[model samples]
Target: SFLSIAIGQETPYKAVVVTDGHQALETVTHVLVDLLLLDYTLPTMNGIELYDQLHAMPGLEATPAIIFTASLVKHQDVIEQRKIIGLGKPIELDELLSTIERLIA
Candidate 1:
């Protein structure tokens, strides 16, 4: 739901949406290797765990990720430990944009 709006706003470029963390992991082999990886995922493997894996890979450590989750309260330990920008659910447009701009800037 939220990703669609973000991709639309950033369009004229390509967009690939992976529905699950497992699929995302698999796609990383074929799709992510060719692009700049920007992640926003929840639970399952969680963002930081996925990011940690990506960082250890040869060419992905420097890639940036924005951790979007509905479980902020539950995952405070993981979020804080990783220094991730937690974009909470309910999607506040301004805050999301500000975080993205700050990250990309």
Candidate 2:
């Protein structure tokens, strides 16, 4: 995955890639996650819904996240209301790295 490779190469953090929300939930359930980089248009569940489920998990409630969406205008209100950092599709790697460094620190 492009995102995974970029993250792995650009930062010291570990990066894991899951194809869909189901895989995400499964992987995250076992592994400790410092930051969440989510696509708002995931299969089976939207990013917000997945975020809710992930947030409900113990020890992960306060975990930082960046939600990327193509339909930013459509989800603007929700993203703004939440603590999650919102990013648009075809993200700028520089911006993403900057946010990740700030949040993960």
Candidate 3:
């Protein structure tokens, strides 16, 4: 649904989400090399971990990602890491909207 809509859109936009960590990584590495990713923290592999993996990749060194999590305790550390953004969960529409605006901008 979302992936299809994202790919089909006339604008320069595309997205994909896979709940499994291994699959997500593989998909990104293979199926979707050109995409900028926004992954949720509570996922099977955890968003921070995924971000780190992607960040280390040769072509992905400058790629952007947003991490959505339910825990504020981990927020400061992620922000301190300096390449990722943390969005707290319950996933409010306005908050998500704001984060997306900031991310895409």
Query: How well does each candidate superpose onto the true structure, as a TM-score?
Result: 0.66, 0.95, 0.68
Measured on C-alpha atoms, candidate 2 has an lDDT of 0.90
Per-residue error (Å), model 3, residue 6: 9.8
User: For candidate 1, lDDT tens digit of each residue in 1-105?
Assistant: 565567458643344677666666777777654333334564477567777776677666666566666777876687677666666776676776666556555
The count of backbone overlaps in candidate 2 is: 0
Runs of candidate 2 with Cα error greater than 4 angstroms are: none
Query: Which has the higher TM-score value, candidate number 1 or candidate number 2?
Result: 2
Prediction 1 global C-alpha lDDT: 0.62
TM-score of model 2 vs. true structure: 0.95
The best candidate in terms of lDDT:
2
Candidate 1 has what TM-score?
Answer: 0.66
Query: Which ten-residue region of model 2 has the weakest summed lDDT?
Result: 76-85
lDDT of each: 0.62, 0.90, 0.60
Leading candidate by TM-score: 2
TM-score of 3: 0.68
Poorly placed runs, candidate 1 (over 4 Å): 10-14, 30-44
Preferred candidate (TM-score higher): 1 or 3: 3
Superposed Cα deviation of residue 57, candidate 2 (Å): 0.9
